[model samples]
Target: MIPSSRNWQIKVAIAVLTLPVVFSPVSEAQVSQTLKAKESEAKQFMGLMNKAQQVYYAEKAGFTSSVSNLLVNVGFQNKPDTANYSYSIGMVNKAAVFNYGVSKQANLKSFVGGVFLVGNDTQTILCLNAAPGKIKPPNPTNTKGVLKCAAGTEKIAQYNYF
Candidate 1:
């Protein structure tokens, strides 16, 4: 009788521990909301990076690949990388470049932002991967003002200023 009672208690404990993993609409919705919140944070951070790059470019006549440079020279106050994402910047072209935020968490959206020098004006675009997978930053065209996202990605925002 004691052995049977102990086995029952162990089984109940296991079931309770696994309850969160069980398939349920409420859990699914909660996960979706959490993912969306993470994506929003990523986008907002990328946007801030974009603006800092723009300012750095104006003052230095070019963009810096170093986040510390942006922080010191452009007065960018936020951390370069976040808990959910790691960031990198590269010059895709002489007059166009991109910043990439790679997702560290599974199922989280990664982001990319492009800055293009179009004549006397600057055009910026932000894009995100259509699916949660390896994200590659788009190589923007230097000849045109527009920045086109690669396959499996979609544009989410754009900024144009003189």
Candidate 2:
């Protein structure tokens, strides 16, 4: 009876140790599938942007205005002080550019900024916004600059390619 009990304990330990190795492949496959789904979702948004003129315009304006404000707040103070600064915001070729002319000239850390989404639903208007052109936000995976969004939110779609 004592010998049988010892043998049972040993068998249980071996099974526990082997279980992870046996199931690891299955988990890996699931992860791959999840990633593919996310990629497909992103592609769908990109396609929408490419075809829908109004949405593209809105996204471009939103990105431009957001970036302009960020630049001004981050020590780029040379503007109208009281009056609002206006810039011609538009998408040039494939990239969104906010042409401010020479109204407020300060040495910017970088001229170009990257746009990214910041919401659970990629289809949501609240999703697309640019990160600050100067400061890289902590935990960029979850937030863009000072903005925070839900986890599993998609980053910027591939509209930049167009």
Candidate 3:
């Protein structure tokens, strides 16, 4: 009876140890499936993000282009002496240009435009007499205006006006 009891205990131990080994392949398969699912979800999320980013930059570029075109039609020129007009448009255009630059570097869709800045002590509406698509090219085009840069000459930075 003692020998038989010892044999039974050994059998129980063997069974206990083998149980996990028997189920390990199934557990591994489940883990692999979970990893694959997560990878697929991440890919989908990245796709959506890319799409959103493209749309956002496209809209921003369009808006900036429209504003610049409007300003050109209304004769909004940059002042060489002062820094007001370029500063304002440059600030706004910088954000848009940065986004566009990132999108372009990421191999995403983007648009381009020209930014012009003009300042007057009192707001004045100047008109462009040129026909559509015949507008003058964007340059310093100060139109004899005063530009006020807070940091003076140290803040002359290159901007993506187009």
Candidate 4:
């Protein structure tokens, strides 16, 4: 009832071919690429929240600290948090600061989005942390009307979305 030598050889070859797929760990490059994708997603999420805040402010005449308010008032669809990041918003010295911090992955970068007034026009800014850790957006300066990120972060984009 035993299989022939040729059949056994073919089965062994097939098993060997599938072994790497089954037991191989993800490579460093692959991990890096995945972390990069998550980082991009975090950034995009911040952008979307910034836009939503713009719309909400236009209708409400003020900014909201709650993402639920953005969803209900502005009709923007998003989860407050994701598997890789957690989102938050609050009034930081008269500015609406949106923050996204790493939730599960250490390699993913954190982000902050700020909505504030600049010379009678509303401005939005997106900033990225220098490295992955718990970072918060700094309060905007009253005299300069600028939203500066904390020392370890850098501003990546700014917009005036009306």
Candidates sorted by TM-score, best first: 1, 4, 2, 3
lDDT of 3 at 139: 22
Worst lDDT 10-window in candidate 2: 103-112
Q: How well is each residue in 51-94 modelled by candidate 3, as lDDT tens digits? A: 33234344443223332333344355533112111111222442
Pairs with steric clashes in candidate 1: none
Taking every candidate in turn, the Cα RMSD to the unseen true structure, in Å, is: 3.9, 16.6, 20.6, 4.9
TM-score of 1: 0.79
Instruction: Choose the strongest candidate by lDDT.
Output: 1
Error of 1 at 81 (Å): 1.5
Span of ten consecutive residues with least summed lDDT in model 3: 97-106
Q: Can you write out model 4's per-residue Cα lDDT over 1-162, one digit (the tens) per residue?
A: 999999999999999999887766666568778878888888887888888888877877777888777766766665668787888777765545554444356666678777886665678878787887645545333347665665667888888878
Tell me, by TM-score, which candidate is best: 1
Assess the local accuracy of residue 57 in candidate 2 as a C-alpha lDDT between 0 and 100: 40
Query: Which portions of model 2 show Cα errors greater than 4 Å?
Result: 1-3, 54-162
- Candidate 1 vs candidate 2: the lDDT winner is 1
Candidate 4 matches the true fold with a TM-score of 0.73
Q: How close is candidate 2 to the true structure, as a TM-score?
A: 0.35
Question: Model 2: per-residue lDDT, tens digit, 1-162?
Answer: 356988999999999999999999999898777644543343343233222332334444344343245434343444422211122223333322222211121211111112333332122221222221222112112233233322323233223222
